[model samples]
Structure formats: structure tokens, C-alpha cells
Target: MNTFKTEIVKTKEQSKTLAIIVVVLFIIANLYIFLIEKENQNVYLKSISFVIYFLGLFFLFGQSFIKPKPIGFFEIADTSINLRLDESQDTLLFIELDNIILKYTGYGSWWTHSIYGNKNYLLIACKNGENYNLEILLRNRSMKNDFKAFLNTEALQEKFQLKKTKNTTCEF
Candidate 1:
């Protein structure tokens, strides 16, 4: 009955915060190299800090792909699932989806699985031409559980295999 909408203003705020942190890190690196390191100029520490500074830039680049928040609107009705994306002017409705897989994307995905947490992207991947296959970012733990429960149960779950194998059928 509820729809999860993309909070554009929240995204903007997060982006601004990330930009500020990155800028501050770059400034700190510069300050350490020029002002603080006037004594010994420890090359190893400087190199490490420089790497950290570059990592901040890399994070900025990767942030778009690993969204800071849910980027699409998701609705888990009694029988079907609907995905609405602001990025694409399209509404993808699924009465019976082929596969509802939880895929992990990122470096060290296994470590993500084993240690930190499940970096699972809720993938509503269907077969050809429908082309409405969507990857939804999951931000909250409760919502992720709710999504899994909804998809793994009777109505919508009947269409999916839920196995690790690939299923090519698309009936939505």
C-alpha cells in the first residue's frame, strides 16, 4: 500500500556533504605536505595521506553508482511490484516477475557478504525487450527485509525460481 519515493532533496544534501568532506580532505593533504611537513618531510606518510586524498576523489566518482539513498520508487502491493524511476521516465509494473534476485556489486563483494553486511542490490531483471529491468538501491535494513519477504512469498514469488541458477523466462 505504501510507495517509496526518491527523496531528491536528501540526495542533494548528501552530495553536498560528500563534496565538503572531499574538499576538506584535499585541503588537509595540502596543508600536511606544505605546512606541517617542514621538519623531516616523511615521504612514506605523505604518500599514504596522498593515497587517502585520491581515494576521496575515487569515492566521489563511485558515489553515483553506489547511490547514497534509494534512487527509485518501489511499491509492493498485494499482488505485484511497481518500480518508478526519476532517471528514466518509465513505470515498470510486474504482475509476475521472472526473477527477483539479490545481487551484490562492488569490490570485495564477498567481504561485504561475510563481514560488513550484504551489499545487496534488489535486481528486478527480466528477459529481452521489456527492458524495464531495474536495480533498486536499498538503504534501510527494515525495508530490505520487507522487500525480501514480499518477493519471497506466495503471490509475486510464484514466478521466480529464487535459486542461484539463471532463469530466462519473463512472464510479467
Candidate 2:
């Protein structure tokens, strides 16, 4: 079994930059809506925009407190992928993975590199209709490469498939 530890990148800078961008965009959006679209102004859309911005700000600030911790190793073998969280090694889930959404791009979908740095993740949907997500904080890309290699192995050959979506490189 291959074990990889989680690595957390410097998020303060990223967060700061993101916050600035979001605020600027929010101001610009509101200005555009009120100034240009005045004739067709809808109260509901404006309210929703305010709500979304407020919620977005809340979550953005919340990121400072909620840090994802990698519990244990992803024990990969021929038959299944055993997820062992913590020292018990009892295996959290025996992943009989059938489909993988290989979303190297997208926000709110996969690959969240903006807010959480050094955090790598995998979203797996198994044959039995269970969806699993593994978020590990690692310093480098080795873990990502290793995981892809594991998925490409002959043991999991025909059953596995990759999925693509229309989204940005990373979601929050």
C-alpha cells in the first residue's frame, strides 16, 4: 500500500486575492445591473445577488476555520481501493470504482486549488451507486500522479471510465 501525507499550501495570500477579486466583481455586477438594466430591473434577481454575495462572503471567511485533515492512507490493490482513516486501518470504504469524473477543471465540481492550496482530491462514483470523495493535502503533484496511475492499472481496467465537464480549472 502506498501512503501519502497531506500538505497545506499558503492560503492567506490566495484567500486575500480571492476576496479582493470577489468584492470587485460584486461591486461591478451591482453597478452594471442598476445603471444599465434599470428599465428591466427585477427585485428578485437583485435580492438573490445580494444573498449570494453575503453567503459567499460568509463561506469565504469560514474557510479560515475549517481546514481539511488527511486521516490515513489510500490502500490500493488489485480488487479494491481501501480507504483507511486514522491508525485503526480498518478500511473506511472498499471502493469498487466504476466511473471517475476526471475533472481537472471546474469550480464547485472538482479540482479546488484556489482556496485550499496543496489539497488534492478525487471524487469516485462506485458501481454500487455510492459517491466518495478523498481530499488530501499534499505538498506536490506526486500524489495526484500516483492516484491516476493506480486507476490506470489492469486490475481496475474495463470497469473504470473518465468523465469530463464544462467548468473552470478549480472550484472552491
Candidate 3:
């Protein structure tokens, strides 16, 4: 049996700086659209505007203190795999290796696109039952491979009575 752990990597200072710049731009845009333009904004648009503003402010103020959470862990017995979530884990739609459906490369690209040219990710279903993609973003790929092998072991399956779903996929 092998115990596997996964943690969310913290954003770098440059990332934080960029986020701040984005928030500022968003604020400027909203001000222009709402106050300056005097465009006939409805309640729905107002609500959305407020939400975006709040998020930007939250990120700006909270970036210095907020830390990434450990989202996942896996334990493999002979026939079954146990996936555990840490207390700090955010709610993800799903976690499996084969869920990845696409790949691309760019700096600060969408979660659906791998930052590194050849990297890949698993597209977990969202809480809304839609496919929500998450980048693999593993700091140590070799360790992840070892953990996957342990999860696939036969002994673990029998011990945990694991259930297999056909919809999931994992890509490296």
C-alpha cells in the first residue's frame, strides 16, 4: 500500500502582481460602463458588476495572506483506492487521470490549456454536472506516477471495494 498526498501550489509574487493589475483594470472598466457611460444598466448587470468588484477587492487584499490548500490524497490497498480530501480542499467536480480531453501551451492560459507545451490535465466534472477542467499541475510527476500505480494495485481494490467509473481520465 502507498500513501499519496497532493497540495495546491501557491501563486508566485509575479502572479499576485498580475492579479492586482487585472483587478484594477476590471474596476476601471466597470466604472466606465456604469458611471461614465450612463448606459441603461439593469439590476442583473449591476449585481454582476458588484460581484466582480468584490472578487477583485478580495483578491487584492487577501493575496498576501491566503495560502493554497492541500486538495487531494490517495491510499491504495491491494484492490481498492481511497481518495481523501484535506480540510482545506476546495470542492472539485472530480479527480481522475483519464478525464483530460485537450491540450495546449501558453503563459497564464486557461485551466483547460496546459502551461507547458506538452503537459496535460484531467477534466473533472463540475458541481453543475458540466465538465470542469483542472490542470494536473503536479510539482513532482514521478511521485504522482508512483501513487497512481499503487492505486491500481489489485490488493487495494479488494480491501477498499473500490468502484470504477468509466467517465474519468488522466493525462500527463
Candidate 4:
């Protein structure tokens, strides 16, 4: 009888924006140090700044090549999970809970997975030998706790294997 809904958060876009801001600031600082502050030059400090600036540039440009993930909604009910990733009609999907063989949720590794973020992906392996990957957005602590509790409930526990891992791996 429990139900859960999805929330959209633009984490990748936020990261890319942060990288761009950092790169711009680094560029300004490097220019000030190399061109304006030439009278009191510190080689080590200047070299470190240059290295950091390049790293920022690399991150900023690297992010540009990755296509952004589309916004989506996951409606999880007692019997099924409804997926509506895009607004288009072709993007609708419905997965029956009874058919699920395995469910993987990330609850490990601080650097690779966040306790609450857009990166919290749910992997469902069905009895019919189909695997589906969907990003779940748990906006707050209460929501996250509730979702985990639901998955670990007696009914679902008997129906499927609930796995906690450092990260969810899905091959499409």
C-alpha cells in the first residue's frame, strides 16, 4: 500500500556550472599573479596556481562532452513502478513488482554515491530476465528512510532480493 514519487535535481548541470565558475576565477588569479604581481614573484605558488587552473579547465571541458540526463518521474506502488522519463508519449514504462528478481540500492561509498542526490539509481532485475536502471530522487531524509523501509518490508523481501552496494552497475 506504500507509494513513492520522484523529484528532479540537476546535479550534473550544477557540477558543470561550478567547474566553469572555478575555471574563470582561476584564470583571473593566474593573470593577476603572472602579469600584475611580477615584482614579488613566487615560483612555487605560481606553478601550483597554473596546475590548478589547468585542472579546472579540464573538468569544465570534459563535462561539456557528456549529454545531460533527462528529467523523469518514478511512481513506486505496492504492485508496480511507473516510469515517465520524458514528456513524450514514447518514454512511458511500467514495471510490475511481482516480476522483480533483484533490487539494488546504493548505501555505501561516500565519494561514489550520495545518501541523498540525483545519483541514487535503482536497479531492478526481473524474473523474465530483463534489467532496468532508473535514477531515483529522494529529496529529504524522511523520504529516503521511508523508501528504504518499504523495499525492506516483509512482502517485498519475499518477492525479491534487496541489495545494498557501493554503486549500482547497469549494462544496457
Instruction: Name model 2 segments beyond 4 Å from true.
Output: 1-67, 71-73, 85-96, 105-121, 136-139, 164-172
Of candidate 1, the 10-residue stretch with the lowest lDDT total is 107-116
RMSD of each: 9.8, 10.1, 13.0, 8.4
The residue-by-residue lDDT of candidate 2 on 1-172, one tens digit each, is 5433343222333477777777776775566556757667678777766765675666556554544454565565545556665555533333456665443432221235333334344566776777766654433345556556766777555555654445434322
Q: What Cα-based lDDT does every candidate model obtain? A: 0.51, 0.52, 0.43, 0.56
Give Cα distance to truth, residue 27, candidate 2, Å.
Answer: 5.5
lDDT tens per residue, model 3, 94-142:
2322222323221222232222211224333333555534332343447
How many residue pairs collide in each prediction? Answer: 0, 5, 19, 0
1 or 4, greater by TM-score: 4
Give the winner by lDDT: 1 or 3. Answer: 1
- In angstroms, how far off is 148's CA in candidate 2? 1.8
Regions more than 4 Å wrong, model 3: 7-67, 86-137, 148-171
lDDT for model 2: 0.52
Global CA lDDT of candidate 1, please?
Answer: 0.51
**Per-residue lDDT of candidate 1, residues 1-172 (tens digit):** 6444322112323477767887788778777777884577788879977886788767655444443444556566665555656665444445435566655332122223212222334556554445344444444455555556666667556555443223312111
Models 1 onward score TM values of 0.44, 0.42, 0.28, 0.49
lDDT of 4 by residue, 1-172 (tens): 7787765334564566676778787887678566866767678877777787777766745443443354767666665666665673222223434333333443222332443442555666565555666655554556667776666666566654555454454211
Judged by TM-score relative to the true structure, which candidate is superior, 1 or 3?
A: 1
